[model samples]
Target: MAKLLMDLTPLSYSPALRRIWLGGIFSTVGYSITGVAISLEIYALTSSAAAVGAVGLVALVPLVLGGLYGGVIADTYDRRKVALAATLSMWVLTALMAAHSWLNIHSVWVLYALIAAESLFQPINQAARGAIIPRLVKPRLLPAANTLMMSVGTLGMSLGPILGGVLVATLGYQLTYSINVLAMTVGIWALYRLPAMKPEGTAEQPRRGGLSSIAEGLRFVRGNQVVGMSFLVDLLGMFFAQARPIIPALAALSFGGGEIGAGFLLAAGPIGALTGIAFSGFLKDLSRQGRFLTLSYAGWGLGFTAFGLIAWVFDGQGQGASVRESLLRLSLAGLALAFMGWADALGGVYRSTIIQTAAPDHIRGRMQGLFIITVVGGPQLGTAGVGFAAEAMGAPLTAVMGGALVIITIALATVRVPALWRYVPEPVPDTRQIPSV
Candidate 1:
């Protein structure tokens, strides 16, 4: 019975992790809300899916640079300091975003610049924290630890949009952006309490990271099939079928709810993900993570395929949708997204665990940086590509086409890399070494 639920052991075991996990809930919500708000804001401002999709294009270069450079920064210096500085910077930028609306100085170019800058710092923070976690918790509890983190992130995904939708609908963009500024303090405080997280072996061979360091990291990934495939598979999933850019259009033209409908569509995947992670105790000791990850890819493809078909069939202009009819249409789409999120939960956890566990600690930060790129940056790029796609082909056909590609790509990859499902993590014993300030 207990194994059927999320393992609470990680929360119980580590004080530092516990504090961050708790605070992260709020900050993650803040981040999640702001993402949706930006999309809606762009769509409202320009009414162009291309403009909305451009958000991803603006963010892509920064994300790639950040992933490459951020990994080096995390590996070379004190990770805690890096995460702290980046978090504070992110807070300030988000505050500026609030000002852009409140001060009535609205420009998509300015928004693009701000988002691009924010994208840079975000990955630096992610790389630092991703590398630091293995130091905070016992090595054995790594899977559980990641599950807990995923829970918080997924929770933010679930709640942020609903709240963002309601607030954006009722309050307008000015106030909607301010909430993130306040919510992030909790996470900043969490980082403040964390121990100094220096990567292992830094004392004896401490050095700065450069292009050479990045190349070395890339080499490692190229050689490690499991970790390499994890990144590849995730990129394919997000790049082909990521549905965010077209969501507003889907709401207005297909699903019929406007801002509220858009919000429901945005939040659906996270809600599904949260439900899966909340009850993920059964996955605690499962060794067949690779097998399940492959299965997850299949399910992810199917969910998006299903979602696209529903939108195509029930295409409705936003004007005349009865409240009940709108609700029904949105529910169907959301349900499919939920199923995708459920399937993604399995893949997300397994892939993350595999990456964190399989990589040597020395290069863990670098690997995690790449992981963050795939998980976050890939979606950003996809949003841009598919945003334009939605504009050209309409949301329904674009989604259907993208989902089909995902299914095909993974099937071929699996056949080529037969050992992906055969991989298992190399264990490290518990070492309670939390570096202090």
Candidate 2:
């Protein structure tokens, strides 16, 4: 048991990583606080589930653009600087959001704009941070390191929103946003302490930046079948399996428990993810990453399908269902979400490990940037898609149908992309060697 626990040596191995991880936890907590606040505020203002879903649509384009260009910038300049700049931008935006709420700015459009601004910088911040991990830890410990990051992140995701819900309910939006501002400062401090992270070897020159750099990154992904397939699988899973945006509506209209219930629903998956990561010492030795990834997605689909079924059977538009029955249904729904979260976190550990281990350091930033886009953008797109579908067919039906689609798509991808199934991390070649462009 001690030996298994010690697999997470990366946390103790690198002070830089430790600082980054701690800072990320604080930042994520703040983000979660603001995230719940904004969603609830938007829902309250518009009284429309579609309006809450539109938040995802508002931020998606800027996030995509930031991710692509942010990769180019990270490749061309000091990544630490780029990341710090982006983090600072987010910090400032959080303060602005707080101010907006504190002063009673009632325009939903202003809220949307603030969210968009934050989204623009988020990918840049994430891309640099993602690329920095491989440099911080040894190659042999990459999986453990990834698991540790996921575990901490899952911890934040689990606790933050629950805390957010309570804080927002009692303290209101202004104070919740202010709390986020303070939390963000921890991330900024961590970035400030990091060593400079200039690109390895010949960095891309400013003149060879922008579209040229993006094209090079795309070319690399295109040529790597395993990496390409990993991204594809993740994209499909997120696109179909994301059902978070409807939690508020589900809580109020289906479960009869309102905001607190929504928070529990939101927190359920991360709770499961945290639990999975606690036992993830075995993952470091796993070689059949492709198979594990496929199984994880399948698990996510199954769990989501179960959640939908529970809602369909027990919830009747929050009408006539007794309080006891509603609570029971909510508990079952949370259990299903927890199962899905565990599966998703398992898949994330492998996906990140494969990407960090396989991609060479020279273009790792660009690849990580693309990875950030897929991670961030896919869910937003999913939210928009699922939200629209829910508007048409209701959240319960949407989840069932969407989860089914994820299972079918992943199955097809596995059968079609045999290379992905057979993928194993190759030994890291000389760091000085760059792939031919």
Candidate 3:
């Protein structure tokens, strides 16, 4: 275990890794702000939970479309260029959002339209960013590197909501949008500093638009039971079990706290994630990655269940609770959320490591693209499903039921899909000897 973790230390400061991390940090911060900006915008305009969910639905289509096509693009182009182009598009979108806010367009559909356009490029950005990591650090450090990435991402995710609220409350939406633009500039600069990267797999010679490459990636995933199962677990857990979109409802209605309270609840998960990353060094030596993954999934579901039940208890008190009572309930909810964050982060590292270590270099980009789809798709599916369930059954019930389902599903998956449990970590190759260019 100690040896596995030590591998991360050396790679942490490798020049290429440093460059990528710096850029990723900036971009992540901007992404963090997006939810707050969009939600507040919708809430201010319509004050409807369903309306806010529409923002996610709008982005969902483009995200899926981009992830599918983006893989082909990544496989076909210079990776740096692919990333650069996506970053540029994001920059344009941010600027446009700022302009729309400043002009007081107040057109809800307009915001959705721009977000949808931006989402199309996001998959490419994510795939390119992920694909670049292994090249930057050795395989042994992959888990650690991913942990670092998650740490930065969680920090950004945490900060985005908090800051977005403050920015919206103080500077207004235009200013908040402006800050996202600035963050994009910083992201672009970081990407600029990175050296050009070539795809690892056989560069599929672009031949009159064929499905062979896509089939090949699918075939690769299918052939590897571990990777296949990892993807499915993550997708299912996130899509069906995630309860994040319900926080606002809990805060506003169930818990008697409003927007600020909701932000705190949303931030709680990332806080747990940050904590998990802090101890990521310990994960390096654990050969029982599969076991860790299954446990993490189960843990995540359990946490959500706890949170939902707590919300139900608070709701049952029937709306006249004291300020202190409300605060206590919210605090407990945050704690439960924090647990969910940690579980998800741990599982994420396990699954990602499996994908990176198992896939051949030539097809890594394509696999990553598929991975991006599952990654984004699961949450979007969750957003839609959770939103509907919450609307129909109410937040507390929705959360509790969702949580219970996730736990059961993961537990059943482990027993039924023994492949996930029996999996072992592959030997981390020593890449120190790979001569620098």
Candidate 4:
């Protein structure tokens, strides 16, 4: 029974990794709080969903560019230093946000600019930290490490918003941002304690840290079938199976539970993901991560399909219905979302492990940089896709259709990319190091 619990081998084996993991918990929770606070504040000021949503839109370009360039920087400089600098920058940004709130600054543009700055630093921080993981743990324990990271991240995602809401209601946005500023100190401390992590093997010339470096990372992805497929599968899963954009509408229109239903639907995914992570011990022994990645996405699609079917059946019944009248259907919908979250969590665990383990050490930072983009950018695009489709076909049909497309696309990709499907983690030769071109 104890063996069924999440393996603590990585934490037990590496003190450095443990500190970093603990620090990440605080940092991620803090980020999650700021995310909700920023959106709510924006909406309060503009009273437009589009304006609130534009936070992502405004930050997206810098986020992508930052990720690509950040990867280059991670590979070129001391990864620890890179991460520390970025983390401190984010901490300063959070402090500034708190000041803005406390000072009664009502400018949405100032808020947007802060968000954009944080977005720029985030990829550098993420890429450096991700690349540092393999250096901290044995190659065989990578999955366990990845699992721990995911669980911490999912916990933050799950609890951050709830805590944010409570803090804002009781203490106001100033305190909420202030809490984040304080929480960030833990992450900074973790990075500070780590030994300098310079890239292994031949260093790229300083001049290479430009467009050429970004091109080098892209070229590596193009050449590596397994790593490329991991990104592709994740993109397809998020792009088509994303259901968050419609949760509010589904709660009000189909389940009849209104705001309460919406809250449950929002929480269900992370709860489900946490549940999945708790029992993910078996993944450590699994060699064929590629096959599991495919299966996980299939499960995600099925989960989404089931959720959509429930809504389709309950369509138009939720409007003006009391909570008691909608309880049963909303419960079923939450269950379906739980399954979707669980499956997505499983995919994330394996996909991340494969990338970290399979990619060569030299360019791992660069790969992780591009990976950060995919992880963050994919869902934004997916929300746009699902949101647009929902407008035309209703949320239920959009979910059903999108999920079906996810299943079909993954199945096809697996069949088409045999190299990806057969991939197993082993020591990858650093033959394809980024050459100055």
Q: Tell how far residue 3 is off in model 2, in angstroms.
A: 5.7
Question: Which candidate gets the maximum TM-score versus the true structure?
Answer: 1
Error of 1 at 156 (Å): 0.5
Task: Show where candidate 4 strays beyond 4 Å.
Answer: 39-55, 103-111, 165-172, 202-207, 251-263, 313-330, 426-437
Off by over 4 Å in 2: 2-6, 203-207, 317-326, 427-437
Q: What lDDT score is found at residue 339 in candidate 2?
A: 98
User: What TM-score fits each model?
Assistant: 0.96, 0.94, 0.92, 0.87
Which of 2 and 3 is ahead in TM-score? Answer: 2
The best-first sequence of candidates by lDDT reads 1, 2, 4, 3
Candidates in order: C-alpha RMSD to true structure: 2.7, 2.4, 3.3, 3.9
Over the full model, what C-alpha lDDT does candidate 3 score relative to the true structure?
A: 0.76
Tens-place lDDT digits, model 3, residues 1-437: 44323234634467767666666677777777766777777767886666766666788889877887787777777788899899899889889988998999978999989989988998998788777777777765677887777767887877777776667767888888888888778778877878878875444545324377777778888888888888877876786665556766666666754556666777788888877776677687688898899888878878988988988887755254443657888789889989998888877887777887776655677778889888887887787788777777887787788878877787787778778789876565587222210
C-alpha-based local distance difference test score of model 1: 0.86
Rank by TM-score, highest first. 1, 2, 3, 4
Best by lDDT: 1
Q: Per-residue lDDT for 391 in model 1?
A: 85
Per-residue alpha-carbon lDDT of candidate 1 for residues 1-437, written as tens digits (9 for 90 to 100): 78889988988889999998988999999988899899998898999988999999999999989988999888888899999999999999999999999998789899999999999999999998889887777877888899999998999989999899989999988888999999999999999999888788877764754887788889988887877888888888888888888888888888887788888889999999999998898897777788788879778988998999998998765555644669888888999999999999867888877887766666778888888888988889888889888888888998899899999998899889956777754445566442210
Task: Indicate the residue-level lDDT of 165 in model 3.
Answer: 62
Q: lDDT for model 4, please.
A: 0.80
> Which is the winner by lDDT between candidate 1 and candidate 4?
1
Mark the 10 consecutive residues where model 4 has the least summed lDDT: 428-437
lDDT of 2 by residue, 1-437 (tens): 65444266888989999998899889888888788889888888987777888888999999999999998887777899999999999999999999999899867999999999999999999888888888888777777878888876798889887987788778888998999899999999999999999887643544475898899989989998888988988888888877677887787777755666777788888999988888887777777887788788888888888888877775566654444656876788889999999999988998887777666776788888899889889988888888878888888898898899989998898899877788765554445332321
lDDT of 2: 0.83
